[model samples]
Target chain A: MAGAIRLAAGVVEGSRAALSRAITLVESSLPDDFARATELFVELTRQQARRPTAHALRVGITGPPGAGKSTFIEALGRQLLDGGKRLAVLAVDPSSATSGGSILGDKTRMHALACHPSAFVRPSPSSGALGGVALRTHDAALLCEAAGFDHVLFETVGVGQSEVEVANMVDMTVVLLPPGSGDGLQAIKRGLIEHADLIVVTKADGELRAPAAALAREYATAMSMLRRRWRGWRTPVLTCSSHSPADVRAVLGCVRDFHATALRSGRFEQNRSEQELRLLFSAVQGELAFRLRTDARINALIREQHRRIVGGEVAPRVAADCLSTLFVERMRGGQSAQ
Target chain B: MAGAIRLAAGVVEGSRAALSRAITLVESSLPDDFARATELFVELTRQQARRPTAHALRVGITGPPGAGKSTFIEALGRQLLDGGKRLAVLAVDPSSATSGGSILGDKTRMHALACHPSAFVRPSPSSGALGGVALRTHDAALLCEAAGFDHVLFETVGVGQSEVEVANMVDMTVVLLPPGSGDGLQAIKRGLIEHADLIVVTKADGELRAPAAALAREYATAMSMLRRRWRGWRTPVLTCSSHSPADVRAVLGCVRDFHATALRSGRFEQNRSEQELRLLFSAVQGELAFRLRTDARINALIREQHRRIVGGEVAPRVAADCLSTLFVERMRGGQSAQ
Candidate 1:
């Protein structure tokens, strides 16, 4: 109890070392540690999270691997810190084998940014998640706010359908693109493009600057055709070089403008509500699937049904009906009559 | 009733014109016509679809819109025709206002194949689906099979997340890719790729042939990683040039091998059963959501809850819980206690 109280006080007092240790504790997987972590999680959710005026903006940055996301984010972190804002950067990398889970070693990739006064960099591995956003990214973002970080940035590995999942959690989504590669535009998923609050053409430094600018213009024109689902705000495409603070500031200004507009129009709350429902539905579906898979009787019955189906006794629809019925009954704690 | 009887008889007798008309009727939205179509569908499902042994091998071909899907499928159809196989192609195109719904106009794109004796091409526009597959693709596949097509190929507009929904219903999935694009291996989505029984690198002609072959090799290597989840057969990636009949034959051979393996291992029934469950879940979710949107009392309660949520009196999760509780209670006609 004393240790827990000390940890709580350390977090509330804004000790980076203490916060880092707390996050490590949260990410730990050992049975006893996980139980302790769950206690911390519950306490954190109860005590530190109830801020009325001190809301933190959640930003999501995603691009393909090898797209220089770390470098750009490191530069962006410095820019934000210079403006006197505290930032929390969470990069979700692929899972680590040593700990048998995510280590979040993204700080190793952005070494200079790690030592910054007003920034925290945490790398959470993909952990074989198809949707990319580590399940803990949401909780970590809230914790960063509770720890008084003004801004929280989530960096995704930018593979598969994970970008959309990140979009659901953030206030704004920035899609990073590498320059000199014509393949950049083609790789931008329609789903991702639609959800992006801003598109940034990165690596706009050197001889590739002209091509990057051209790509930015192309995205700008393409975005014009997609009708904005959000009433007042239009998704913009911009060019930036990690080497240039001016370009980085311009991107940050866009983020600020989007947030201001969203807050003023009540779209922010609408977006949050939609996200909450989505999370709830996703949780329900995931839990339902997990329960169905783990129920020994149902699993065995499913196998038997599959065998009967192969032997040509039950129709596919009928077998599905039985499963759904069983799943519902089990959810209700027995195979009751429907 | 006589008209329905004639339609049923014509379908059973494998009359080409009758099958085309039946599909047209099924795709119609007119209320009275839909009533008749539903009756026809029920009769067809009962009498014809029960014999899974006689069902056509339903193949789903999907990729990006401009990936030359129609041309490639047409070429493949011609090859199958020459080999004495009757081919029925369902092209699911995005609905354009000027093109009218359910176009079926492939004459301009594949003029030669349209005239082939053993080929029947029907292009149905996606009416309301944001995902690539037309709303009618699944039922159309069933109708085509009932009409005696040995092979019913569903050519979706592209490989978006929604396209996987269509692929789930088909017996085999063939993901088409162009050569020289770095996205070859990146196209392997966890949800979609596992369903992709065969991967065909299309447009592998002229300068692109070498790169296409390389891409195929990369896809095969990537597929090997996923092979652990795959039960018995390997998901082979083959290179094919639509202009080359031999390349087309290679793709055809892969399909035959996949089908034979599925049948021998009894995976076909297992897959179909899983698909049925997914379909039912999707249907229920859709129906419930639509009802929630349309029902006045529920809609009113949801709006009221949203207003409360925006005012910060209630957390979004609690609001959702309340709404879902109300919805489920109303859906069940107040039988269960809230």
Candidate 2:
């Protein structure tokens, strides 16, 4: 408890080192770390409840692997700092195989920004359960806000479904596609159209500039046809070039506009509140899995039902009901201490 | 119990009327209907366990609004009947408003096949919870198989993400794209590549023939580049024209080949077992939500946790643990009768 309190004190004092350590602690998903993280978060939440910290503008940047998301982020990070905004970049790639490369490579790609005192870049948390990783990322973002970052940009690859969860956690989701109109086909595969607040036609450099413009126009037409998920704004498609760096500001401008409009329309708070609700339910799922996994009686029940399910002796849905009834019955038999 | 037995007996006797009624029973998702459905399924499972009934080859067909899925199914149904195969076409559209049009439109599009003695075309079950809808569709498929259908093909619109669930419930998933290569963008929006076991270029007739061929080639190349989730056979992109019923045989042949290779490699059984496991877990989630709604104390606990979550007094993950712990304690306090 004392250690957690000290960590919370360091975190609230705007120590990036403390914030980074807090994130690492929360990322482990171990029971002890989870307990400490909870204590720290509770203290953090209580402190903020009184002090009322300013929430940072959370912008989610997602694209395919080669869409130059990191380069664009580097350019955007520099722009934000130049505009006198403290920025934090958290990349949420939840794959262990690529985590090492992703973390190291991100630092290399954003070398100038990484060295900047105003900019903080943390790689993906160590991957475990997808839900757990998402929870940690959400906490890490809040920690960055508590540490007084003016803006937090979450960058991730959209091939996995993690981006959808990340979108719910952020104020705005920006999906970037490569230049050519043909390449925009990928924007569909990635399921970005529905979730993005802004879509960037990235790598609009050299000879790709004309094609990128055409692609943007094509996407704008496509966007018009689809019903918007949120009110007060329609997702816009724009072009950006890492080489120019100025285009970064254009995308950032759209981000600012979206933030302002969503806040004005009340969707910002509504969306954040809903994200918390979803997080609660998702955590419920995680907790259920944890209990079923760790409790011997629950594990036995699940195994028995699973066997019947696999043996074709009972329907999975029916077996699920049996398991549920048995679980309640077990709990009723006074085995709640564990 | 007697009513359930009667329904089970009739279903096992290959009576389409009984099968349809059993389906309706499962589709309601009402407590009485769910209880009856469970009883009927338990009887059926016990019987099948003793007699080892042959499972039908389940296939899923999904496409965008105008991909000609129903027409192709009509064409394919005739061919299957001509080959003396008993086929069941279960269309699982979960939206009620669209259900009215789909049920009516499909009867019109498939009038000939619907009236044929060996063919059965059931429209989507009445809409409800997506999980419930998915559960009922799966059970309906099993009933159709138990009713002696040699082939049971599930048909649904791909836009709803329902196809992903249907994919898990079936042996093969076919994603249909319209003729034009340009229209293939709809295929992109539908996210057909990753989950599709076969990509069909539908409506390859008249002016659409050349375009359909090109589209098929384009998709074949795209399919090759993307990682194949299923082993033993790579996904094949083929062209099919409703005008040319001969193409139906080619697709059926491909489906059979994929099935044969999968069974040979033991992935078929492995896949089916995994589906059962997934179904069991999904049912657990549904059951949890059901309990949370019905159990007052549990609901109260969840409500309190929700308030804490919304108030930002605790992180959602932490709140979830508190809810789980509270739920068990509530149940342990001799409240099981509810």
Candidate 3:
């Protein structure tokens, strides 16, 4: 209990080491750590409520696996730190279904940023349900803000669903694209492109410059055709080269502009509320999924109904009726008339 | 109670007019009617268990607007009826977000097929949640099969999330495509294309025949690269024209061949159980969503948390924690300790 208080205080006082420890506590699967982490998170939120924050720029970078996300973040992080802004970087490695091993070999890739003061970089695995990991990201971002960071960058590898998740969690989303034809275009989901505030053509160095510019132009045209869901903001496509620090700074410049527009239009607060509501709803859904899987009677009832369904004797609606009935009854710890 | 029993009896006894009435009952939005309809469904399911069935073939057809879905289904229905198989059709109107109104102007489009002795056609508007429509579709299909139909087809418009819902509820999924540049390709989501069992190029008339075949070829090449999730079955692409009755029969033939392969490979029962399991999970999740929306205290708590979050006084994870807490406490009929 005392440890949790110190940890909370340390995080609120901008102790980077304490921030890392707090994240570890929250991500820990142990029940004790989980309980303590919840307490810390609540306290931190209350503290956030009592004090005004610097309104940190929360930006997300997402793309296909080989889109050079880490290198680009490192370059961007250095630029922000040089501008005298405190920054925190969090990397979410996609959960591999086959190996269950995280691809967060990201520390070495961002070695300089990791060593720099006024900058903190952490790479974490998706240790639980996707929603759970998302919730953890939310908690970690708050922790960074409480730790006095003026900017928080969320980096993830993937195209479709993860892009949507990170976009919901951040102020602005930047989709990194590689120079190519339909091969890369197809990999970048249309849904991802729809939500992007900025689409960056990565690896725009040396031989890839011309194709990257062409790809950016193609993206610009496609984006122009899409009616903007948000008022007063249109998604733009840009080319950036990690080799050129100027290009990295330009990406940062565009993000600042987007943030300014969001603030001016009040979408900044609107996005935060929407993101919070989404997390709240999903958390309830996740809890219910937990109940469905963990409840002995409910699980047994579903299996029995599924068995009858497989026998071609029970319809899905009937099965749904029986299961919902059993689930509610089981939750109430009451016996059914049958 | 007597009315529900009579309706159940009428449906099971294969009275076409009674079958339509029973569908109307289950699809009713009134609470009392919903209760009666559920009773009717449970009884019908029990009766179905006691009797022997032909194990109806359930197929799902999905595509973009104007993929010739209704016309092709009408033609296919005639072929199936000619083969002495009873058929039932259900059309799920896309939610009003995109098209604003249903294009399932199916009544006139399928006038002949609807008049056939061995076929039943029903078009349902998305009156509630998509899951509600899906569950109603499940119940309606059972009503038809209980009425002795040997084949059931579930059809929906668009290639977004709703298609995935229908795909989960049916045994075989048929994705329809029109011959075009990247329009159709962009419409088919990556996840949807991965699970497709058969991809059909529609509108293959005399002038469009060549492009249709080429589209089929392109789809075949892409499908070949996808690893089939179901054992011993590969997704195949074919061309069909509504003007040519033989092409209609050929789609039926291919579907039968795929169904036979699934049965021979033991995937038929496997698919049934998997599909049933998915429905069971979604049913629980849907109920949870319903509860979240309806419960006063939970709703109030969520709104309060959302307001705090919007004020930037709370983080998302903190908001989720508070909402979940109030929900549980309210479910217990007690005030939160805080």
Please provide TM-scores, in order, for all candidate models, with all chains considered together: 0.61, 0.64, 0.65
Predictions ranked by DockQ, top down? 2, 3, 1
Question: Over the stretch A66-91, how does candidate 1's per-residue lDDT look in tens digits?
Answer: 56788889888888888899999887
Question: Could you give candidate 1's fraction of true interface contacts?
Answer: 0.06
Clashing pairs for model 3 are none
What candidate 3 gets wrong by more than 4 Å, as runs, is A28-33, A46-53, A93-107, A129-131, A183-189, A221-225, A292-338, B1-7, B17-129, B132-141, B148-281, B294-297, B311-314, B329-338
Per-residue alpha-carbon lDDT of candidate 3 for residues A1-338, written as tens digits (9 for 90 to 100): 67777888899888988999988876776756766777787677666566756768888888877788888888888888999999999886545322366765645568889898898888764465334766777877878888999899988876456677778788888888878546555856576787789999999989999999998998899999999859998998899998898899888899888989999999998887777787877876676666466556546666787787777666666677666654444333344443
DockQ, structure candidate 1: 0.10
Candidate 2: tens digits of C-alpha lDDT, residues B245-326: 6898898889888889988999888888888777776677677666665666555666778787777677676787677665
State which candidate, 1 or 2, has the greater DockQ. Answer: 2
True contacts kept of 3: 0.47
**Candidate 2: stretches off by over 4 Å:** A29-31, A47-51, A94-107, A160-163, A183-190, A204-206, A218-229, A243-246, A300-317, A325-338, B1-5, B12-16, B23-35, B42-282, B289-300, B328-338
- The local distance difference test score of each candidate is 0.66, 0.77, 0.76
Tens digits of per-residue lDDT for model 2 on A213-312? Answer: 9988988998998888676788899999977867888888888899889989999888888777777766766676666656665566677888887777
Ranking by lDDT: 2, 3, 1
